[model samples]
Target: MSDDLKEFESDFATLAKLAVQQSEEDVRLLLGRLVRKYRQRHPELAEQLNLSLKSIQTRSGSGALRRESLSEQAPGAGVPLDRDSRLELLKEFDDRGGMSVPLLPSGLLRQVESIIQERQARETLLARGLAPTRSAILVGPPGLGKTMSARWIASRLGKPLWVLDLTTVMSSMLGKTGANLRAALDYAKRHSAILLLDEIDSIAKRRSDESDIGELKRLVTVILQEVDHWPDTGLLLAATNHPELIDPALWRRFDAELRFSAPDTELTVQAVRRFLGPDTEALGQWIDTIATSLKGRSLSDVERAVTTLRRGHALRHAPDEELVSAMVGADLGMKSKVERLTLAVEMAKAGKHTHQEISRLTGVARDTIRKHAGPSPRRGRGMK
Candidate 1:
């Protein structure tokens, strides 16, 4: 057997032996000490193992360390294994396994690297007398890469990203929501995983507007307290599309605010070139023109316009000018004459009215309207 496997086997044997002789408290104490020793000796291995050490101090019980058992009451029971637990502990030793590392695109790599360095610097500050900042808020419109950056950070830090599952975590049971959140926070703290709270504005909105202010206040209080006392070993990342709508108090908890604004003309062109190739040169110029025309539009808008243009081009086998015109017109807030026709077509497709009804309402051609409607999933379904 390999050295690592031999070592793990030896450790497991020792635990089993101790469990047989020692009291439950003694076994737990012994296990904790062994875990600490292992961590000190092989920090990297310990991290790879993803072992969580929780002290189970309760009334008298069996001293035996139950192997591969699942109990909600057991300390640190809900912590997920780094690998599938179906394989016996001994089998896991033979099976090579490792965590997947996330890859960030070249354009965003430097920014994510800087965030890691900033986190390290904060750790150094905490080593001295100064208190390090505990939280960060990533603000960006949809699909501008906020979530991607957060995932990259977690991977780089060798931490699991515990995405806050509001649906599962939120409970209608009286007083249970708060307790569940607290348990989750405690679990996060124990495991040293990055607690990523995406769409934070949904939960942390301004309390003044809430009809049930008490519940909102309590939830916010728990969040703030957790942020305040979060260990320096892990990072906390929160993201929001609507930063302005978030509570003002929520801003104070975060150490840094990273704003991912819409890409400039140059960046947008680069992104398009990267995603699509040199064949999209004319499309890129059109995009640059569109970007200039719509200064305040988001990256999402640019992407959607490009997707629609590509789809339409493929459907109609159209030339560059026709495709670009269709794309630009379909985009919101554009003043092109074709834009009105595109809007009417979209409204009609959405079940508002038929083409004849649309034409009667807006004085546009039913055939022309049908042309702009593009591929209809509803029509395909109907044909089927």
Candidate 2:
């Protein structure tokens, strides 16, 4: 086919894919790009496309979206903003078909999946004289996938996730912080959007604290009332690293509370495989050792470490065994002497490296590895 025809086919396929995914914003963006691309050779087609684009923009600006589903509207449609700073109080993410399932433990994964299934079958519950879970609080340390899980829930339900930005909601002007928060909450309710209050403890501190100003106390009051009366049509999620700081009253209002912690051994191995991406096959032999060393770390840390390994191997031509050895050696400080010796034995038994190499990597002497795991294989069998 001709170059022009190939370009046209590619653009057509992209538009079809976006439409199927119900990605309105991406469809509009692609259409706008096409209009510019064909303006010279296909002026009439470009003009027609431009007119259709303008009509959609006019509808979006004229409040037609409120009458329709909020998820189908643009990312910025009707988002509340702070009065003094004019910063957006809520950040929008319409993940749709683009989100990845969060890497959570089986128990936590079931809970997250239950939330999604409940939302999907909400009408059936309502007909049976029941109500779906209206709100939940995710309590955990940072980098444990609370925010990502929220996004995944929204994506599975084919809706948009609106996250409350506490920095923007806390206005400089007196009494304005409460108003900003209220406005954002009201907007989310009006659209029935899945709303996430990230780092909720920042404003929902203990109400009895004598040092907290009246405005903060008022903010907590607002959240308490909102959480209690949040409608079944919308799902409200709050995540916090410091659950202790949250008021006791606020905790009671939530329908459920989900707790997150660092990855365990099994989940750590899964995270290593997922983070390894295309390099998983080439480095499969070292994944167990990597996961053993990275156990108890957050998924974000695993991703960073795996990404660094890939970059080193791809750019610097580092051997897989060398990269794995360096990573294990760096993490040896966190392991006890017995744990180090155990890892050394595993490496030695795998026959992928010499006992001396394992000793150096794990701080366990070669004699200890030999005593525990027998003799290492020929050096030619493993990485040179």
Candidate 3:
């Protein structure tokens, strides 16, 4: 027998035995999973089998069947599917596999989480004559956590993430882009997947731009219409670096409008501590100094800089002070660095450090300090 036939035989045998011995809950759960996988391999055959299975399941008097019924409602079961579907580049996957979730500020974290958490209570939301916020727009500078949050939602909801890659979705062929978007959204609705229209500003720009084609302007209206009618089960998320470019009407269409920014002090410190790992606890009180030095950088900047430092420190056997200096230097202005170094000299003198120790710590010789702060050196770089 072919491998496909062998696998089918094994699955069917297992399913058959489960039906005879397992409780209804166990049987229904396993049956749904079997059908889900079976649909991928033989959608037409699976659809036929699903109809027969549902007939038998209802006859057995199970009042509500979650997956067994929902799987049939998923895309392409009994419903006519488009032959010329233009959404080939769209990817579908579940979970981020424990990848790093960004440390967002509390306000923004709660905002993003509201949508994610509501998605879990979708049935409750719809049953009460309310719609769970289906669509959202994330506005932020590049390198913030907008994209990461989108993935995190998919993982949390345990739904396939349907990402619409604009480069592939946008086509020069007349009227094709709109069709592609509709088909993608339709798929998301049918599967209850998280649909991410990343970089949405590229198409949903304000209509007044003279350079933009009339069709490009019309796309904004089409997007808004789709959002208005988007289903409660599916989550529609749009991320953009420039929110100002999107049409104003489009702005109000989404239920949530979240603005993301670079990490503040607390979040930056958390990111630093996370990236530093065991080294953070080892540094004791000094970790706070490292966190303060990382204040102005984005989470990505800290990750890359610290990761590089780790590799260099391991290879070069550099001291912890080298890494600290690099992080602190990145956050300070050039003039600030000089001023701090000078201040360090004064601070050391005001304390117990010997002159030579102060010189080494400040990278300033005693004569250099006397020349500048002594009141005998030139008043300015060039002016006397």
Candidate 4:
């Protein structure tokens, strides 16, 4: 009986704290449910509890469960500047989020580094008659670290990053989208934060196309006006996958334009080793082979492949030799079971696994494995 009482009290205390922190309606509903259940069997206790709730509600004017006005139940949660609005247009971020900047090709990395240096030496640049690079457009395929570059720039400048939500800012309500965009830009100015308009192609597509609508043209013009007259204190950054779809004049507005591409085999190989750390140094030969096979793939692809390989090895789901053999077979893109099993058997033969284990690993019968491995006889001469 005592344990039951303690558990009930503990549950009530936790719910009460949650109610205070989150919503008052939770407390009202909880107490009401308890009172209704006990009213028939314990009349006096139920009455007392109801009276206590009434007293508490009367004590707090804002605690009443009155219906809200239509204005309170309206569409379009206000822009990020509104204090009462729930949605955030800008996702604020700091350096400690632990997302490492991705490896880039040489020319791209050099341009990004120059941008970082220019931002770091703002005063020095002004003294030397060179202006600080405040605006830039990163154009590339997806997963090339365009968004990461924006955050890295923010971190290096010791500033917070506010990436705008294009979904919320772009509205079908006629001219309201431009107003929302302006409001977001105004909010960014207050904190001197890095404002990343990621995927800018959605809004600033090429306005010269005959099939384009007037609203898109107007939106691009608004962007142009804002970019030209934007304040010097805050940084404005934009990124896109389809740079060709963006207006040509808009390209000229940016101080620096950085183009990104998929990493080559050499960089991918180095990235794979660096990502794997000291765990695979002894397997350097196999690691280099992984690099050679992953040519023409992006850095993001390499990260995913390496992560899967390391995790499979760490989890002990399969032995290291077996896992490496399977991954190499997959990376090599073998088309059928015969080719795949042949490769696996060859890999296992090169490694330490025996013939029976190699047969089991490759999902082939041992006799069939021997037939494929053994030299083919002169079939027509031997039979006919």
Candidate 5:
């Protein structure tokens, strides 16, 4: 290892030793003092160090460490560890194997670093008498890694991330939906965990839209209030493909707004290589072409296209030429709702058929046929 890496390893070893010798409560006190001191002197290090502290707490506890331990610790009155002691403890514990924060790949590491910096700015703002906003809105098309980013944040911060499943929380009965949301939010708050409201626009959509029901409106209101009242110590992230559909109030409440847009040609090429593996050279070229063709498409669409192409190749028992031809045909046009709806209607009438068969009959792209015939029922018909 290089000199810097060797130094880091040594420091981490020392920190681990110190951490292992302390009781869980003692560690919390030590960490609390460390967090306060770090925030005062080197605020940039606070988020990363705080995350490590949380990780140590989680791993050291008998059960899961209560969120209250971090947020509701007795006001002042803990270990007398200062910045140097905390740093030494961190160095000792750096490699002791208890939920060490996963480092992002090199390309993404810079972005993660920027997020840490932004978090420090928010903390500084809060310290200066501004109300600290704990909510973040990660707006992106599907599969651009918005959810992954949220999980990464939780991992980096040594906090458990609770992904709110809309289906579980939404209810048909009056008042039940709001109640469910409140219960979930309270659980998250009490745990001091990261609450990820994935595809939030589905539940917290604009009230003015004709399709929205009164129950949804109440749910949105409750959600907005919860976001407004969120504890500064915890993180709340909401991710959506359709940000325009989100309620205005919710939009304004977020302290940080990040957009995970479609990957450019370079990123798409890298992703194709990452997913398809290096040996598939012809397949990679086909993906490049598809990526070019689907310029404005979401990451989900790119993945779907790749899967369809691979399946088509596999089922045909075809060589590279045939596989390339099939992929090229599918990549001819943009994915369209009308095309999908038409295929779904045709499939309903035709009964179950393979993608190629559906494509032949409906004159639609084979990829489109595959997508529409997925697990979901057709637009107007129930699955039999």
Candidate 6:
């Protein structure tokens, strides 16, 4: 038999297996390739297959393949790339087992958990003639684990996460921009992978803004349509630090909206403890003092500060009290007199430092610390 015939047989065998298993997506994808392959050599056969393919894509209901799934597969079935600069448009991360749930507030954590649970139980929803959440928008200030949360959701579902590399996807030639985005989205849908449009506000600006050009606005239209018809097999996530810049119409399309705020005092303490890692035990005495000082800050900032303290303690053999004191002292300079007094009282109550040390570090009077905290425990009680 000719090599072409052998190839045809193999393709037919795989298609038959996929059909028997009711893998509609795989069947659709294979039929598409066969249609193209036979187009020139056997135009009549190709025409028949093409007609059937179009019918399958446009068929309405729960099991139909999305129209965008008809998009040509990216070369070699790898991540999509810009044709001009060959820059990769989608960055792939397969963290099937390694990713951990990001540190988040209790309320925000529940929202994230629900998203994962819904995706895992997608079949149950389909049975009831309902669709699972196909898309969500993560809105908040930066450095608050929005991206990490996307990773965790994908990890829990046992799927690879494909993050859109906006730097590469945004083309200088505006026409190519839309094409690039569609190609990337189509590829993600084809593989049923989680696709995160990080910093979506960049391209999804308000359409009413008069300064924007026609092509840029067209990008928003492309995204709006994709979000509306996103397949149940894939999860689409968009994250933005500035939600206001996103078009109002685009915002309404997401199935859920997750808001991430700065960590509260209790959450900050938990973040500090987690970030301290192995040194959490060594610096256990100053956890409350550190948490109080770091309150109102983002979790990322807390992690950075804790990491620096851990490094100093490990490398320079710096005492935990001195490191914590220096950090708190630097922060104290920015605080008002009342704020400093409050923090000083907190430090005293922690009983990890004497009144003299707390007053010196926080610039509060020793007498005031004693009056507020009802006197320090003892000299030896504090870190030497």
TM per candidate: 0.54, 0.75, 0.64, 0.61, 0.55, 0.76
Candidate 4 lands at a TM-score of: 0.61
Q: Please tell me which model should have the higher TM-score, number 2 or number 4.
A: 2
Off by over 4 Å in 3: 1-88, 96-101, 171-175, 204-212, 278-286, 330-384
State the lDDT of candidate 5 residue by residue for 1-384, as single tens digits.
486465445444534533553334435654565567568655876677788777876676644435443224453223112232221100011111234232233555465556655555643443344434468888866677777677667656655466775544543333555765676676666555567887787675434555657778778888888787776556788888888788788799887787676676666655555555434554643444444444555666666766766776657668644554455446544346574445344453444334554454335666665565553223421122
Model 3 Cα shift for residue 247 (angstroms): 0.4
Worst lDDT run of 10 residues, candidate 4, spans 375-384
**In candidate 1, which residue pairs clash?**
none
Clash statistics: count for each candidate? 0, 0, 0, 0, 11, 0
Q: Model 5: runs farther than 4 Å from truth?
A: 1-113, 117-133, 204-217, 278-287, 310-316, 333-384
* Model 4 misplaced stretches (Cα beyond 4 Å): 1-86, 96-101, 171-174, 204-212, 328-384
RMSD to the true structure for each prediction, in A, is 14.4, 12.4, 13.4, 19.2, 15.8, 10.4
Q: Candidate 5: global Cα-lDDT?
A: 0.57
Q: Which candidate is the best by TM-score?
A: 6
The lDDT ranking, best first, is 2, 6, 4, 3, 5, 1
Worst 10 residues of 1 by lDDT: 87-96
Flag the better candidate by lDDT, 1 or 4.
4
lDDT of 1 by residue, 207-306 (tens): 4555657776787788888777665556677888888867778778887777777666556655554544444754544444344433345555555666
What is candidate 4's CA lDDT for residue 219?
75
For candidate 1, the per-residue lDDT at 102 reads: 24
Q: Candidate 2 — which residues are off by over 4 angstroms?
A: 1-75, 171-174, 204-211, 333-353, 370-384
Per-residue lDDT for 1-384 in model 6, tens only? 497787666666666655664546756866888898988887988898788777777763435454332123454456667888887788766677676568888889999999888888764554455667889999999899998999899878877688995655764456688888988887776666689998897775433556656877788888898898777678899999888888899999999999999888888888888988888787877787789988787888788888888888898766667787788877777789998888888778777777877776788899988888896777623353
